[model samples]
Target: MNMREKTTKAENTPADKVEIAVRLDSELLEQIQHLTNDPSKVIEVAIRQWLRGEILRDDELTRTPVRTPVPPRGEWND
Candidate 1:
């Protein structure tokens, strides 16, 4: 089997999902491994949650009104 086949054979992965490697600190990897046998699931969930928050923040920023600076009180100069 080729590299793609090996990576894409992860359990519970969708057919459309393809694997891409990511580098993580050994300490972080150990912690993740302790939490669950399937690190991919944890990473995927974390990414989804982060993306959702980012999207909401973007939407709020787009909807927020832009503040216009008020001109200093003075006689109008032609």
Candidate 2:
């Protein structure tokens, strides 16, 4: 199997966590490298904050109605 196939198979594994690749700008990566040795943790935390609506773009902050929040899994009784 080639590299792509290997990556796809690994990503599909039934595990609590799976590895995936992301591309980042070289300058941004360098900045992250300077801040922490565990960049993955930083990225994960940023994603979680975004999901919780703690982070938003300037345009999004001014948008009408705003985005509706998703209810937690157990609350979807309808």
Return the top candidate by lDDT: 2
lDDT tens readout by residue for model 1, 2-64 = 765665355556777878799999999999999999898889888988988743566677786
State the TM-score for model 1: 0.52
Clashing pairs in 1: none
lDDT of 2: 0.82
RMSD of 1: 8.3
- Model 2 C-alpha lDDT per residue in residues 1-78, reported as the tens digit of each score: 776655665576669766779999999888988989978778888899999989868887787985889998888976
Could you tell me the C-alpha RMSD of candidate 2 in Å?
Answer: 16.1
Best by TM-score: 1
Ten-residue stretch with the least lDDT total in model 1: 3-12
